[model samples]
Target: MRWERGRRSRNLEDRRAQGAGRRTGRLRLPLPAGRGGKLSLTSLLIMVGLYFLIGPEALQGLGGLGGGGLPGGAQVGLPGGGSGDVASGPLRTTPAEDELVEFVSFVLDDAQQTWARLLPGYREAKLVLYRDTTRSACGVGQAQMGPFYCPGDEKVYVDLSFYGELRSRFGAPGDFAQAYVLAHELGHHVQHLTGTEARVRRAQRSSPGDANELSVAMELQADCLAGVWGHAAAQRGILERGDVEEGLRAAGAIGDDRIQGMAGRAVQPESFTHGSSAQRQQWLGRGLDSGDPAACDSL
Candidate 1:
């Protein structure tokens, strides 16, 4: 992807230097690697709920959420502090961090700009970059929770190191794959603007038993929306050979089914919130093929 010279987004909130010892300081979740070396499904579900329903404040209350300072101890809202610090950090990047940030900003700008132009009554959303732990309108967002969009705040929070996991453990390595992740989060923003997220939350509350399925549908729609952006990006002559393949790999890598399978359990369809790998690929493919946002409304 030819993203280096693209427009950088002004919506990026750099909270990397806020320092540690926060007000209600909560623990960070473990990364996809390390001692336990596995993503916790239960914790992630809790995070998803906090991110979308309760808010970040709820994260601090989770009993098992633990970890010392992030390698850099950069607090959220402090631009480029903890997660962006280069010296002695837990998830330090090897010179590519700036490049990754630039790439992320560019894609964000593209997606939001697209929405602003195409969607009626669209409001721009901010992207927050932080390290191990940070405070958000939703509650305390832990880096271990992976990237999530907090609808309450209308902001997307990401721990940059997750990109490394995207390349390594997730088996989806490429610039476009990273873009897909950002686009997926932005898709949540789109949902917020369109009231889809609110409807999903209402449905989840009204029917507790179907919450996971509803969540999966919402996530799958986001994947499709990401694909729609991919299609637009391709038409702009930025997509290279195999870029689509990289994106598909990413959509599959983070699927709830794949994550659960990696955790050594039988794939329980009812427990899935992000859809299966095949479903992700299918919806993403639909978006990529059509490039129309309306075509992405699979739910």
Candidate 2:
């Protein structure tokens, strides 16, 4: 994406180096101490059975990993070692990081501007970049949970290292991919501002069995919003020839099915909080093709 000359948002918050505090210490997991300590076939079968029964959450606990004892930690699936061991801190980003930040800020400005012009009483949302954990209106925010928007605070939180995963592991490399991620989170902010997020969350509680489906709709709508931003960027001459493809790739890379597959499992549609790869691509394409926010009603 041609983003350098674009407008940067003032809502970008850099808290990369603020570790909250140093980790207690190196966490040493227990391993069986014996000759030929390979797990028994019976044990393996039982573990597999548990995996099939309880899902990825069981797998993480069985492995004795996770930062904050949750899945998708630095040890489990993160690109960089999640420690943010920068001499100057993760907030003291490099020129390349700065470029990415600037690009995201510009896209955020574009998306918020679009919303402001299109939606009544639209308020700009703050996007925060932090390392490890940070306090938010939605309790402690972890980088492992990836980027998220807190509806209560009307803020978006991200850890830039995730952009590395978006590139290396997810195979969605490019500046535009990063922008798409930012725009998606901000799209959640849009949902919050429009009261869509709260209504969905409330409905999720009442309809517990279909909670995941509601979340999928919410996520897909965000993808559509991101696509809308992509279209706007194109009209503004900020998008390059392959930029839309980059965003589409990103939308696919983070699909619930692809993520579940990477974590070693079958694609369980009912369990998906985010939509499937095809659904995400479809929504993104819908917005890209139409460039209309009104067309993003996945509900």
Candidate 3:
């Protein structure tokens, strides 16, 4: 991607120097019981009840809730200290990491600008750059969760170290891949602004049994929205050769099925929260091919 000349976003909040507060007790959700551990209707109703009582925050760490960069939105925190290691001193970064920060800033601004033009009264969402852990309106965010958008606070949270894991562990690498992660999170911001998110939550509550399927649709739609931004960036000469491929690779890398396979678990389509690899690639490619948000109505 040709991003050095791009504009930096003013909505960025760099909290790397600050320490994360002390760890809080996590609320664990019950796993599905019975055949293949499928969530029983009773279990589903229990989660739905929790949702009504505590809002989405109650489902913060739950995989398939569309809160993280990866399919399950995994949350991993460092042990000891409220702020983790950075609490002891200022954060350090290599030149490459510094450049990565600038790159994300550019992507944030560029993607928001695209939305501002595409959607009326579109407000910019802030991006919080933190380390190890940070407090979000939804709950505590951890590095292992990858990048996520919290609708409660209308901000995107990201830990840059995840990029290294994305490259090495996930087998997805390239600057555009990193940008895709941010774009997808911002797509959640768009959902929040347009009432799509609220409506989905209502639907999830009303039909608890369909919650996972609803989440998959929501996530696929976000992938399409990200591709919509990619389309705009390409039109403005911001994309280069292989950039699209990088984004697709990133999308495929985090598919629930692929992640499950990586974990050495059986591929369970019924349990998928973020859809399969083919589904994600298909939706993302649809937006890229059409370059129209209308073409991205996966929901």
Candidate 4:
């Protein structure tokens, strides 16, 4: 949470002023047939989140919301230009939004630095700050999808407005909570670099019935990876009192069971793609307690 004195990342791509240049139609998610010949309520919401809340390529077995290859090391367009091109124009942003940008830049740099020390041959991933919608190698990224990391392009896309929703709607307000979001996405990038994501994708492909379970495991591991960064940050005196709690709250707030309950549906563990609130908190806490990436391998 002590980010004002931190170094800003050079890998940041700011395209807030460029605009999406196209209207995003209402997204309709297809509920594939599940157990018992019909998808459960939990399965339905998982499909909704798959198509709109996470990265477009988060689950490649599903239909293409956008075109891309495998989840790990997928060849795609480079940063700066493409469907999400940045046009030359004045950037309009309020003081609060500008501060948020600075904060994220600091987190991105700090987290990558930690990984560079912890993992061999670690590569830095770019973070794209956009408004409304932006083009990623996986697909068209909209604000509604929250924050996601596209392994195809090795870039993390974020819409700052989501922070407001994280606070007001999800009740997970704090700078560290925002940092956790970016850290988790970057964790996915780490998985991509290490071939963990590729292996998981292959497993999902081989076992179509267990795809959701595999997704839950992958997501929980990412949460733990985020906590690993949090542990490093704390040791460096970057975190203050209550920062860890903010992150845990954020993790719990977006848990599959909690989100299902919020939607007035019964909590179902079988359809969970991101684990339950307890599972998320437990994995994140494990990393925080151990400060070791190996501790996260239990997933």
Candidate 5:
């Protein structure tokens, strides 16, 4: 993505070291005593299903697995594990982590610069870089949840570990794919600033049955907004050949349908919180092609 050509963000805060507190303890889920006390797969699935009902944050913490990810934001506490209070310190980074830091800083700063001129009185949101798990105003922020923006704190949270999963599991390897994820979270910050997020929450309350559908629309709009940032980057020559393809690939790869299929589950449209793969790719292309924020009116 040629991120080195971009400016570094002054709003970047390192919380990686702070998030490295000791694990709370091992989870002891109840299992029916069997021959030799072996736990059955049915018992495992049942326990996991119980946690899932609690919330995404609780499910991930309880199972010690990270599967589903919302497009932009998260709410609720991390069910168990990790220290609640994270001590502040400078981030201790290795050579690879250092590269990631640089890339994130550049992408964030450039996105801020683009929004500033596009939206009058635009304020940059701080991007918090943490590891393992940490506290956020919205709820618990964990590496497994991927990148998310907390409107309550006006900050974007990310863990470097997510970049590995983006390449390995999502099959969207590239600096552009990583940037696309960050840009999408920042897009949520934009929605909050524009009062769109508040209005949507209110509407969701009034029409609870449409909650998932509204969420899908919100996520699709974020994807479009991310494409706007990509457009600006391209005009600045920061984007190289195939960068758009990488971003598009990421958009499709993380769609609700695709993620559900990846888990070997039924792709239920009514249960979709994020749009389908085609919808995501189409919206992203709309923003990139038009290079206008108005083109992202998914509502």
Candidate 6:
């Protein structure tokens, strides 16, 4: 992709220096689905009731309601004093990663620019670049979770190393593929801005049994919104010949079914929170084909 033609954003925050001794925190339990990664009131009440019923000992055995600083029991953390001296100086990276950083800034700026024009009352969300682990309003963010947008703090968190996995493991190598990850997270920010996030969370609470399904819809919508950004980017002629295909490969590569298979787990639709490979490709295609944000209504 022609990322150089895009603008750079001043809202980028570099926190890579403070990533040495970050504790790798993981969620050993489940969490309330939807609304990014916050604990819902209903989940809290259930936890309180459980605490009263079983005491702390048994609760801890059950992973303390996924309290290992993960979202629904995923790894989450940021480097603090425990992680050696957190870098306070400017981050210097290898020539390759430096280019990646610039690409990220450009993509973020482009996405925000598009949203500003497409949506009313849109505010550009900030991006935070960190490594190893980082604290986010959503949960403890580790590279394992890839790029995530924290609705709680209105910021996007990224560990650049995840790009290595995206390229090597997912087999979706390209600048556009990397940009798609950022766009997807930014799409989450769009969801937050439009109040779709809150509405989804409320819906989840109303039907706990369907929480995972709702979460999948939310994720698919974000994917479609990401495609919307791609549409806008393409309109400006930044997209190259294989860019769309690269993005589609990326969408399929990270589908819940693919990820589960990669992890050696049996494919189970009931447990899917991010849809299947085909579903992701379809929604992403919908947004890219129409160039309309409304076309991304996966919910």
Candidate 5: residue 245 lDDT (0-100) = 96
Cα error, residue 197 of model 4, in Å, equals 0.2
Model 4 error, position 236 (Å): 0.9
Name the better of 3 and 6 by lDDT: 3
lDDT of 1: 0.72
Number of colliding residue pairs in each model: 19, 0, 2, 0, 0, 9
> lDDT values of the candidates?
0.72, 0.70, 0.77, 0.75, 0.74, 0.73
Give the lDDT of residue 214 in candidate 3: 85
Off by over 4 Å in 4: 5-7, 20-89
- lDDT per residue as tens, model 4, 55-146: 55443432111112112121222122224233335565666776788899999999999999999999999999886567787777666556
TM-scores, each model vs. reference: 0.77, 0.78, 0.80, 0.78, 0.79, 0.78
Candidate 1, residue 201: the lDDT equals 81
Provide the lDDT at 27 for model 1: 51
Instruction: Judging by TM-score against the true structure, name the best candidate.
Output: 3
* lDDT by residue (tens digit), candidate 1, 122-179: 8999989876567777676766576788887888888776777667667889999989
- Model 6 CA lDDT for position 74: 25
Please give the RMSD to the true structure for each candidate, in Å: 9.3, 8.5, 8.4, 10.5, 7.9, 9.5
**Model 2: per-residue lDDT, tens digit, 174-288?**
8788888888887787788888888887897798888777878888888888788788878888888888889888888888778888877777887777788888889989888
User: How big is the positional error of residue 288 in model 5, measured in Å on the Cα after superposition?
Assistant: 0.8
lDDT of 5 by residue, 44-84 (tens): 78777756543454422111111265322232223222344
Tens digits of per-residue lDDT, candidate 6, 205-273, equal 899898888888888888899899899889999899999999999899888788777777788989877
Estimate the TM-score for candidate 1.
0.77
After best superposition, candidate 6 residue 101: deviation in angstroms?
A: 0.7
Candidate 3 per-residue lDDT over residues 139-229, each given as its tens digit: 7666656778888889999877677767877889999999988898888899899998888888989998998888888889889999999
Better of 1 and 5 by lDDT: 5
